[model samples]
Target: MKVSFLVSLFMLSSVQATLWGQDLITLDSLRLQLAKAPLAEKSSLYEQLAWEYRKSQPDSTIFYSDQSINLITREGLDRNIAKALNFKGVGFHYKGDNVKAFELFTSARDEALEHSDSLQYAHSVNNLGRIHLNQGDFFKAYGHYYKALAAFKKVGDIEGVAYAYKSLSELYQSQNNLSKALEMSQKTLKIRSKVGDIDGQISILVELATIYELMENYNRAFDYYLQAKMKAESIDDAIGIARINLGISQLYSVQGMNEEALSYADRALNTAATSGNENLTNQVRLQLAKALLSNGELTKAKNYLSKVVAKTAITRELPIEMDAYYYLSEISKQLGDLRDSYENFIMYTRLKEALVNAEAARRIERYEGRLEIEKKERENELLRANEAKNQALIERQRFQNIALIAVIVVIGVLLVSAWYIGSKRKQVNLKLQVKNRQIAAQAEEINSQNEQINVQNQSLQKRNRQLADLNNEKDTLMSIVAHDLKSPFNRVSAIAELFNITNLTEEQRTYVGLLRQICENGVGLIQDLLDVNAFEDQSRKLHKVKINLMDLFTNEVRAFYTEAQAKGLDVQIDVSELLYIHTDSSYLKRILDNLLSNAIKFSTAGKKVVLSAVEEEESILIRIKDEGPGFSDLDKTQLFKKFTTLSAQPTGGESSNGLGLAIVKKLIDIMGGEIILMSEQGKGSEFILRFPITNVAPVSAGSQ
Candidate 1:
């Protein structure tokens, strides 16, 4: 539910003044301190006030930050200037003026570096990293974060190190490396706990909970969420409380505990409203709407969803806005408001597409901005270098004029010295000419080597093109064979079927059976070949749709049930009542067909073939276990290779061209799924297919 990473810049510890019960008291204390304190001290207090007001009052933050900056400038307090600049940048950052924030942070970083203030410099660097991270410049953001971490470590700043860890955790989470994210979050949590930083610990706990939730460790996630909620309650952090409640609600909603989910959603909504945070309010409202909708409370769900939609129209929160429209559409459909449902659905689709396009544009803009910044920096460097060179040239020219004046005073002596110098210069020129000739010889040799390399490269290119052509021709031939040869085999089988086997001799019946068997085997082989070709084709794409795994598995297994029965093999299915997945139905069918066929083919008489599906936190595992002659070690090594026959033969004289598993592997890869084989020579084989649960509805029994 909490997909975005927590920006470290926003995770400021509560000031001591705020602990005294009221913002007004904190403001009075700050103003009193400013009025009585000296100019130098006033700047520090002003910065403190800026920090205090940052979350609640952006204008106040900017005003205090400016006051601090002005006083620091007048007092020539260079060391504190970067802090003020950083505070001002935070104000702009919160106000969504990222460009201005970037400029201020850059200046702050430069000023801090100039004064050798490692701690301040790291803060500015971290802030810049946050900006880049938000802009989707992961590489640049990573570089800045690493630099900040090193700087913080150099200064032995525990708080800075903790923040850097938290930022890195967020970065890893963004990359979907949940394991690394958990590691970093834990590291940060340890530091926070050691320092008794309750606010920081609360943030880290929520992060850890979210990560565990994503990993499907629901119990652990719930424990962490409860801990975070207790901590937030102890501190009377309404916003934090709201966040924890929302997380819990989402967890329960996903688990289909609608009653508990609705309870938490209501609690979160109240807390968010008390906190007076519109963003948090909207988020909780959306969660509440989902819970209400799930419970069939159409009127209440519509009320909450409509509020969020109206709020998001002004906030332009694309993700929540889209969700609101989507849920509204669902609610409308449930209430039998067909026109409204259709309209809301259209809006949802339009917004979703717009958000995707906007994200793509933002990425492009970030890259372009980075390039422009680098180009400008390079130009500035060149200008500075040219200025230095010009200054040096002027000094050199001044020295030359002085030397000329001195030489005029001793013109005759200089002429004699010049003659001696000219003789040495001529000797040097002769040696230079000899060196030039040697350089020319080396250049010629290099050019000849370059020519040979070019010739080899051209030859390799030609050979590569020929190989590509051969591969294309092979694919074309396979396609032709699959299409052209299948018809003839079908026609032969039909003609053979027309013959009356009862009137024929025993030998004729045997020949007729053999012909039909050959046709079936030939057709299967050609289809396999075509599947292999299709798998290799780059243009082939998956047409993903929401499908119930139980339905698909049952249908596929039923198709081969009769064949299995003929072989004296019992086919069994152990699957959930309803398990949904977003995948290409045809491709998934092929995968199931191959695995099921192979199981039935190799399974001996009186053996059982079991197909089972189990849902994990983040993925689903579909296992096909067969009591067959398991693969040998060598056969396992070459398994899933196209057209490579292994030691295992079909039990019922069924055809095995060794392309089934290969096609299965390819399809799994295309679907972003994984296949794992667990087998032993004497034991049965279990083929486990794992597909990540993505873009699919939650698993629910008897739900469409």
Candidate 2:
């Protein structure tokens, strides 16, 4: 519409959460309150600031969201944590880091679903729709938008419903379904006006204008653009006014009024620049360049286009970049700069293809193909149903014919009845033959599809084998690296420990202590690496024997006594005498050691860790409770993952290779035991393990 292939700016989807329904508190006031707020209230304050700063300062929004997440997670107040995550992803989305935004959005959605936070779930779902839309996956985008819209409606969130409606309108407009697009826009406008959202009303008006313009209804489009302009100017929204004017500029350019188009483009660019929103400023420049190109002002157009291209190096606007390169190539060639034109053309081609990658393109093709297949299948099903209905009708006719023959025999017309019956039988045989032919054709088609599926399955199997081989190589590499690094780390740790007895200053002693901690961390990492390889081996076997709980507890306590003492922590045992169980002693010892070390690692200097064992009805229960910073519910889900990074860090600067819990989980499974974590943030944590006293180990335990 604008003599270029650029996507409309209005088509970019907005996040579900905005300043709508927010409190009237200012950012400065929120920050001031945050400074003096107690720990319990700070998380909420941070969340408020995050929403407040979302539009004007995205980086600040991200920072505040991080602050809120940390506090809420630590305090075990998970109500607003998912919302904070959603807001953080919104920040990244605005900053044009779609990949990072997608990750955060997924996490937010998962967290919301886990906690049953319907509102946040809807927000996150709508935001995910926006990401998919921006990435040029229209089919997926539509599906996500529909899902979010339903969610919003289910939650009775009027604003969220409007957001999803507007998103759908934009998506429809992009795909050139102007009628449906207009309908969706009208729905959005009704909601906007009902809610008294003047800005939203203006946005919808411009969107309606864009759709009409694309429909070639220039007069109607112009009227809507003017209405949007009046509303934007009434509210003194500089950026909004600029966008409205830019739309008008495109309309003028379409009608070949180059002079008027250039005038409006200049005005829009000036207004956008004065608003201090450089992203909008650059976008207006792109449109301005198009107008100039249409007016045959090649040099001036090239200059404006160069500025737009420069902005793409910062935040990727694929559509804008693609269009800019396209125009640059054209302008360069017209200016007799053939080499420059060629270079720009190459870039234009690449960016165009990159807008939809090969993988996404294939997915879209498959989606369309599957839709077609489903349509045909539905048609076939209907055909079969109709044929069955016809057959039933024919069967009823056959019975009625038999009754007619009896009547004919009673009336002495046997010859006529026999002739009619023969004719009817011939017709039924013909219909049956046709039906059988159709069935044969259907079977052939199904056989072809089955062949295709078989080929696909074979391909999938090959890929899986390749992945397995890669995993094996990774394990081998990990073992080799661990074996190679263990000796060096041990030597470093030993040397650092020896320095504790030397005649050194306090500062030197502090350095030696830091060195010792580093060495210990390295050794821990190496050990964990080897453990990963061991746990992944299916042939790794477990040896079961009788294990006394008191002896095991005493030995574990003595082993970690020095480590606990160094951190100024106390370890207590609460096991009765003569406590015994039949299981792999080495497996149990490793599990106890790992849990104890973790308890000590996370406990503060004055906190105490309690380890106790008690006999239950069918099993023995073991509890390792720590009076330290406890884990959040979210953290509990990640406890047994290999090398999972969690919200809580080790207290006293102790290191965790993130493999101990994973190994412990594996060993417990092999020995026929169950482990559960009971924890609350800022309170304390307890790990409970249950094992059957008699016949504990499973039959397969000896096999691995």
Candidate 3:
């Protein structure tokens, strides 16, 4: 028994050494290794070795795979080639030559279909669709995914079907078709659960969280993210864990809690690095840079972002490179490096446009190819009909000539006519064959042209998408600018007239007071606008300082104390003085001032407005509740939108510019924070804001 165990151990060690060896060794080595491996493990081993080989030496990977494919293409070996082809395509894909990869995948898929290898076919289709998706050819990706879904279903490949649904969900989500994204993701989750695929379920959870986040439903997003994180941890999947951390960091960054964001980013970066996932590493690095920048850690942010930019160039990661440049633009503007900002921004936009245009060009080319195919079929049908008609006419002429002649002559004419008809038929057939050859040649040429056209279409589509995104961003900027300019203009005009008037009566004096009040409001609006624009443009640098929330609240409440007193209102505070936060002083000041001012303006006479804060898990929640007529139904929906407003009269009948909340929203977005309002018909309204307490310890800082 001991001797037998020793022999088994020796064999296992040999297998492990071959599998985990740093080198490809040799084909002989692979063959020997394969001979030792169980049939079930042989294909997977080849796939792994091929992928690893592809990184530094794709030719060698292909050589090995091609040898495998040929060996397997013999009798009862078609299934083997399908697997080999799948690996070959993956190798090509990894080399960033998706066109060749897609072709190979299609070939594999076709072979799989011929052999009725449903699993291989499904996998091939999935890989092909993923390539299309990566190219931003979403429609083609969707078609491929659906085909994969059908194939998987036919084979009862639940895991395959679930994977297809997940991909489909991502495609729809990119299109902003949220309902469909939700539906497909849910289906994917269900299927994965049914199959007991924990890892698959985790992926779906991440997607679901993203969908919820896009819908501005943070609670749902948070729940899904946590669920995904737990599952990832349970599975010990480093990549999944890294991804969940990245998602968590993003959520925190969006809420302007830079410290927590950085913590999450740090975790992601470590996991991704350890896992040796270059894609996740790049992504995590970018996120860390963004988080640092948002948190006002400029030096660290710049260092990280520059590293990401360099890494992007090295890796040729266009999407990540674009993001890096965008972040650089923001950083440069904050540092008051206008020229650098402008250049980086332009580069970022151009790359984005180029990608969108590429996708569009691909779509147009596909459509044009379809039309050309239809035309060819029509032409072929017409040529065949013409040939048939000519043959019939020749036959009739021969019959008539034979009938009109003497018996022998008629017979001779008949034979001659028959010979002529046969010769004519042969000539017609030859012509038809030549025409067919020409058509086939033309078809081949057309296909090649169509491929080129498809590439151009993809280019155009990418550009189009980029333009649309830019246009949306531009609109947001313009709205804020317009609202800001209008307020200042109104104040300037009012001030000029008030000064121009000489003989002012008591009533006129009252009017002047109101005008001054409006002007003051305008000035405040101008400040908010300037702050938001400066931050977005990166013209204003951030200073990170720790803050105590209670002290911060005290100062804000004090600043508005005069107004509250005049309105016969009592301000109630429910925050813990010991609770601390860390963020940019100016940004936090602006956010709180806006929220508080809006609350004060809407509060009724002699009403109590409550301000409170509480810590939940890793987040800080602040609530401002007012006992006043709440937002109207319409206002509740459009509160933060620029221009659209309830135009509600303040307690003192003062006119509101409606820029406060808009500015609040912009500032919050810049700070990476979230703000939400809960309002009833007349009872009261509550605004809840959440931020994160980051890694840095809190230190007292002066209020803005």
Candidate 4:
């Protein structure tokens, strides 16, 4: 067999070399030569031929795909570029070079995004996701699948959406999420039917049949299999026919119909052979072996299983090969060949463990690669945006230069004309000269005013430049803050999830708890950051309405109940509902949310917090007090100032980022209200928020 393989490789290489001599045909020539040919002509004469040759000479596919990319990229044809990239990635994948495949898919995705081609973007995402899925990184694969689904939905691409849905369903099915798998498959079927996608419909039918088989509903599963077979026959799809036969063989085997199962397996093998798909042929052979084992044909089963294992090994599909060994071990045991069974079982376990470890390592590598790619793309986008802004600034400067030149020319002409007029006036009589002098003096006064105006304009321009710089800095800071905060919290949540999956030491468990608390505080800090950024944007509107102070206080207190529980604190609300003031619910909510959150953050654990609202003549006031360590004198002096860093710490040793009071002050000012702080060194602080009353009269008895 080894000698035969060497000879075959030699013959294939010779054939490829012979064909390489005639490959000078350009794409244009191919197009012109096949102008009147059928749709299959391109695949048959070009893509298929190239792909077949790539089996013996993989470098040839890289060469052709690179040529394709170069030609299309030079023409600025983004769609063709993405298509070339997809082909390249698929070629690399077929060659068992997943790293290269991932790189090509990422490039394709970037190009697709650049063109705003969501369908192509989704295709790239799906391809990348498949790589991760095959590597067993289920979490990363899920992320990619969801991203593809979202992109496909954005462009209303029903076919793409169906494919994504089906892929996700398969992933979930593999992970034993049967309910979600069935739901996703149903959705895929609906979409395929809606779009008249017969191929997709058949694929979904197969998935549904598999699900039914998993549930041990043999009758229903067989019914679905028959329907899929009919659909395949209608379309004359050889691959689908082979797959259906394989499914039927499994159903028969599970039902203990040995004869029928063997016959169906034989049919599946014949169909796979006719289709000339090695993968399908190998799969059907495994089914045939399983059927033989069930029929008590131990010798036949051993022979078939050996063939299956050898074929899978030659194909580098070690995982499937390992399964074949395990099945052989079971068959040997049933036949009372203990020695053979033990040997095969040992080999199967060793191979399975090795494959599992390799797959885990592959997953880690893939995730790291994806993250690196994402970071690079982010940097590239930032660079491109900055370049655009610089170009715009340069363009503006150019325009300003032109305007300045024009203004200088106009001023010079005006000065020359004035000189001519003054000289002419000097040559006239004394009385006329005196009037001309007065007119010239008025002209000088206007010139002085114009100079002063230009000076002020320059000063304003300088200030505007400074503001623009500050705004740009703020944008950069916000981007950093937004990106940094989410991921840490995500990591914390992920760590907490591991607790449910594995046993941990007491110290480790406590550490995880502390991590969760820190993450929650981080979330609070993020909310404050977002609020501060919104406040700085200067475009927020305050909603104003009449509100009963007591009702507002009660609502705010209720909102904080869960938060108080987490800290083991008690919250009390004391207020009257009859008193009312005018304010927007959103603004009031913001003020109350910030104050309560700060109170919770600053107070000691297991303390009591009280909220009170009351009316004092015309003004309505609400106050929140906590029984915890109060603020120092230094904190009170600069409490509400922007960017003020407070030294006060919570009794739990939690540090504050100090933007809460600034946001509260902004909200209060927007509502035409005020907040006052009163604190003793040892007692907790009290925040009193006051708002003016509105002119809404209550229902009168006379009216009733």
lDDT top scorer: 1
What ordering of candidates by TM-score runs from best to worst?
Answer: 1, 4, 2, 3
Error of 1 at 457 (Å): 99
Clashes of each: 0, 0, 34, 2
Per-residue lDDT of candidate 4, residues 1-704 (tens digit): 32233223333333323322232344456656556666433332344334444554566666667766665656666565675687778778656577678788988888888877778789899988877765555787799999999998988888888889988886777677778988899899899889878776787887788788888888988988898888889977776788788889989988999898999899888878776566667777888888888787888888888988888778866656887899999998998999999999998999989976875665576567556655665776898799999999999999999999999999999999999989877777677878899999999999999999999999999999999999889877986877788798978778787884688888988888888778877887787787777766667666566566666777787888887887888888887656666667887788888888778877776788888877776777788898767878988899898778876676555657778789889888877888999898778889998776453335344522
Cα RMSD for candidates in order: 29.3, 35.4, 38.2, 30.3
Candidate 1 residue-wise lDDT, 594-630, digit = tens? 8999999988999999989888878888899998889
| lDDT at 90, model 4 | 70
Error of 3 at 221 (Å): 2.4
lDDT for 471 (candidate 4): 89
Off by over 4 Å in 4: 1-64, 73-80, 93-156, 170-176, 194-196, 215-220, 252-260, 273-279, 309-317, 371-704
Candidates' TM-scores? Answer: 0.50, 0.42, 0.42, 0.46
Q: What lDDT is obtained when candidate 2 is compared to the true structure?
A: 0.82
* TM-score, model 2 to reference: 0.42
> Which of 2 and 3 is ahead in lDDT?
2
Q: Which candidate ranks first by TM-score, i.e. highest?
A: 1
